[model samples]
Target: MGAEAILEKIRQNAEEEAAALRRQGEERAAAAAEKIRAEAAADAEALLESARRSAEELSRREDLMTGLEARKNALAARRAVVDEAFSEAHRMLLALPAERWEALISRLVLEASETGEEVLEVPASDREKYENGLLERLNAALERSGRKGKLTLAGAPGKMEGGFRLVGPVYDVDCSFEMLLSLVREENEREIARLLYPETRAAGE
Candidate 1:
């Protein structure tokens, strides 16, 4: 063959080889890029799932905290109501009218006079009520009830709220309004709660 024709053939073969090499490199690069894209998509999906789980956990914790706070507030409110009810009752008893108060004192004195000879220690505020007529009335009631009517009032008044104390030789009996209510409260706190919260009682039952 001629030299020019041989050289032309050699150049054409070299060009075809270069084009095949370029095509192979491009295919390999495209495959690598596809792999990288798939990996990135999987990583993004995993991150999204983790974030969703975290958000759900945080939401649940918040809801639990809110419920506990609400329950605490409700319990506090209920306690306040019960306390107010007892306070109102105490105020009413302390403000009893004169005639009713005298009768109550007489009744209490009669009940407390175990020996009927105990010294009656009354509050200074109520000393005049007993001195005027209550002491005589209490003695008569005690005598009628088959006890010695030898009760005497103490010279110095006692520290009391709204009742008297019987100071005997060996023991003493406290019949103050505060004492009476405290005793009643100790025995009947649940009943009072039930009356104020019938729904709670019904649920418990």
Candidate 2:
């Protein structure tokens, strides 16, 4: 072959080699770019999933808090109702009659007699009636019990709130209007609450 032809062939071969290297580099770069793009897409998907879970959890928590607040409001309403009922009951108890009061006292005296020695302390709003009949009835109760105890009537009458206090030296029995009402209120507080505020019963319970 001629020297120039040989040289030309050599130059062409060199150019082809350079062109192949450039193409390989380009292909590798494209492949790397595709891989990076796929990785970025996967990362984005994971982030979106995480965000969705967080949002769901927040929603659940909000629902729970809302329920709790509703229950608290219901409970507060129930408590108000119970309080009002107790107040009314106390009022009625205070309004009971003298005869009723005397009967209650007699019964209490009898109960006291069962335990031990009995002394009755009677308070009547009507001092004249107390002086007239209260002592006599209480003494009769003691006599029926087959035991004797002194009866002391509060000197001042009618001005005091209704009820009697029976003391047996050591143990004391209270049958006053206020005391009886308070005892009943404790037992029936829930019932009263339900009657006054039916809607709040579930929350209160």
Overall lDDT per candidate, in order of appearance? 0.56, 0.45
TM-score for each of the candidates: 0.58, 0.48
lDDT of 2: 0.45
* Candidate 2 minimal-lDDT segment of 10 residues: 14-23
Q: Per-residue lDDT for 91-131 in model 2, tens only?
A: 54455466654555455455434333444454454456657
As a whole number from 0 to 100, the lDDT of residue 52 in candidate 1 is 32
Residue ranges of candidate 1 with Cα displaced over 4 Å: 1-66, 192-205
Task: Count clashing residue pairs in model 1.
Answer: 0
Question: Which candidate achieves the best TM-score against the true structure?
Answer: 1
